[model samples]
Target: MNVPLRDPNIVMKLSRLGSFHQSKLSFLRSFLKEFKDWDYKRDLFELNEHGYGIAVYSFKKKNRVYSLICFANELDENERSDRVIATKWDAAFTLFDGVPAKQDIERLKNEVPKQEFGRLSFKELTLSRANKSVRIFNHVVESLSKGVQPDRELLDKVGYLYRTTAVYGSGKFGLADRFRIKDRKEIYGPFRLEMMLVYLVRQFTFDQVNHVAKNKNPKKAVKLDPEICRNLGIGNSTGLGMAPFIVNHPTLLNNWISARETSLKKIREIKNISNEEIELFLGCLKKSIKNITSWNTESEYQIKKIKSLLSDLNKFIMYLDKEFNFKQDFAFNEMYLDLEKNYCEECIEYVVSMMMEPFDDIVTPLIQEMSSEEGKYFNIPTERTVAELKAILENKYSEILNIDFSKKENNLNFWFISKNKEEPRLANRFDENGADLEQPLAIARDVKKLYDLLSVSKNSWTIAKFLSTNNELRHVVRRAFIVEKFPYSEIQDNTIGQEIMPIDMLRLKLSFFGALKFDPRSDKWLRICMFQGAPLPEQLKNYDEHWVYN
Candidate 1:
């Protein structure tokens, strides 16, 4: 059965997009699914008893081997922090394109841990760092040294032994530009290397914990239980840094959300379902309750959401178990219809994620489509007329045009890069004084301004001619054209509005990264965990597909 995809305009709402959950289509999950059959190994492990030294892990298939070279350092308690402002971390990691020689390891050892200040060569595919989750790290070490596993309940609350502050890839800090490896079949999905880095980092955390425990009491220390090790995943501390990524990559954003919406529409169009498929869907939906129940967060906003989500989920499950029938045609569609009629946004989305759990054939094919050739759409379609451009904006940005940018609150914020680290940040336009150097993220206001200016221009003028004179508006003009073709490419709301939850923007991107337990420290930044219940590298070849639920 054929079904129409939702327009990008409606689907790209900050709220709708922000509500996204990790499904079979999420990049990390897809990465694991794609590379599961590849070779996995610890190519190098040269750490000292204290676990302060170098190590390298690799996954090779045929001629290609992506090596993760890890450098562990002894940092004083005061030196370790998860904040991006901090310079030192307990460990630093990079995914090298192939096997590194002695000279390559020596060169990288000097740079990877220093992070931003250190220069990386093109040989590097991705760079990242993780500070120890000191409380858990020390507790696990102490427990295991005494030959005991740490408490599962307490470990589940925080979920990781180390949370990386940032994972840099695609040309930032001299890492190889995406163009260098964009064509590789294995990594065609977005953020595959970053996923590989985080996944390997998860293994590193397990190794470090075991190594420290083994060292402390050679006679008594037993290895960490593989089951417990499987439950612990890498953590991430993200901030406004990730928010702009969605804004900047228009086509990529479109592809990610489109894959999701397409999957939903196809599921909705299904006319029949087998008993086993129905059973699998029901099983996953029931099992995923652990994800919601164990989801820990301190944000009152998120806590309230979790509470409401739990209440609604319970009701939906009750309806499914008691009143619903799988004999009905288009069973999932009917379930979805009932959900939308009865549940909250959180519940509807949660059910939507659970629906994909049973249809690996449908969702698996869509996973490969989540990545986009963003640069292919980067150039302006200069051959179009000013009249055509105006019509495009009028149709695509009808809601955005209603925003009165003259109000102080509507024009409240400006996005900029901090000079020290060159990281993205937002500030008050009137109070902070960097608005003049504002980044091109203020698309809603600028698109309106571009439209106002274009309304008076000759209808026959082409975009090439318009861009030649209106260079400042070039970015948004290019984006407007993108929004025309890729409906879900632009945020419908004014990002600079005083009421903007910048964390919402950050949450949207992090959700795509398969991050969970979003702990918003403030409106601007938050901590999250990645690969929290994912398979370790060694277990990748024969792993449970529903590890996230487990």
Candidate 2:
């Protein structure tokens, strides 16, 4: 309680946020912990010899049942693409509200594979489609059919057999909106249902691959080793489609970062360290080395980060073993200070995650706090005076206010939505044509403008009076008030600057989703693996909470 939370200005920086690692508060890990006791079943798996058919999996507890209806289809090697325009997918999946009947399956069979072109009824909660990582998928199939396990090194290299291009929910494509199911007890956490769908899809991957292998050599084939399956995960290729989300949802972003900061703050406040807790933290830290060392990426940007993380982690390990004393008071606080002083942002944040591994009592309660009722903070305080609004801008957005937006490079980029996909994209403002239609994702720049306008406004005038004339800055006005209450609400950087890395934005969100092995394909898009080394469906009931490091 004595140690202060990290400054929001420092924590909400794109560079620091981009360095975030998965922790206990991550939705996927929390999803597993929350629903582990539910009964899991292969409710309907009707795959053909080539593995093209409908399969359904469910997790049921009492009367509540959520089903994943999967439609695996044959795709030509040339047709398989992770692009949004690719109409055909190797498989399409939807998380159903309850068990899907034969008639319901038939209904979805016609529409699910059609993806964005199709309509999903209110019963479906989330929709996603993935293409095979053909080389890895076939390698697994061939190895299994030939009566052997796939090469461990190869499996380790690729990490997954399928890579999802998109996952949609919240009224998109006519699926059930958040308001419809937000009150569910099990889904109190944000993206819980999406996490559920993805987790179940992971199981489907193992099942489908094994089915195809068995069909290929009915007599000799063996199922994939559960050990190997445990190591594998679902891959995803994310683009700028996700970059705007962090900007668009300020309260939600605050909740996510606030949860992480609160956890770290609480952990650092620990006055005494138990020997057991120390060992658990160190054990997770030591085992997590493989996660860093095995991270594969061709992006020189990420390669440098990985190497720096590994080096700092090793240095930290040596310090812990040879010099640091757990018997000291507020040991975690002391260690955190050391990391901040001596390590890269990646290493500092990675250890921040490991620090929580030993403190379920600290992290568990915070999981429920990550989701936001964003609407609660939507209204601007129109009654407040211009003086108060300007004070907020000055106090909370100090870093943002300092950005020189008049510089051409600082104003070089714009965010816009593509017509066909309705996805957010980043473009060069000078060279690209859509600067005129740019979305208001330029939070820092706009906030700066709001500050400038406030500077000349009468201090005695209420915001209601100010807005009546300067209404164009209303969105940033709303956000400034939101940021006043939710400290981590806005990013403290120039989003449209020439040096901006949209991947940093995507990486921040993906880390919260518990994604691993982030491979930046470009500054605008990247690949990631989810549920890597997570427990399988059947093992859920008794899975280790720290499976990430195991």
Best by TM-score: 2
lDDT of 2 by residue, 86-162 (tens): 89999999999998888999999999999999999999999999888998999999999999999999989889988
Candidate 2, residue 371: lDDT:
85
Any runs in candidate 1 off by more than 4 Å, and if so which?
none
Stretches of candidate 2 exceeding 4 Å from the true structure: 419-422
Which residue pairs collide, candidate 2? none
C-alpha lDDT of all candidate models, in order: 0.86, 0.91
Clashes (N, CA, C under 3 Å) per candidate: 2, 0
Give RMSD (Å) of candidate 2 vs. truth: 1.3
TM-score of each: 0.96, 0.98
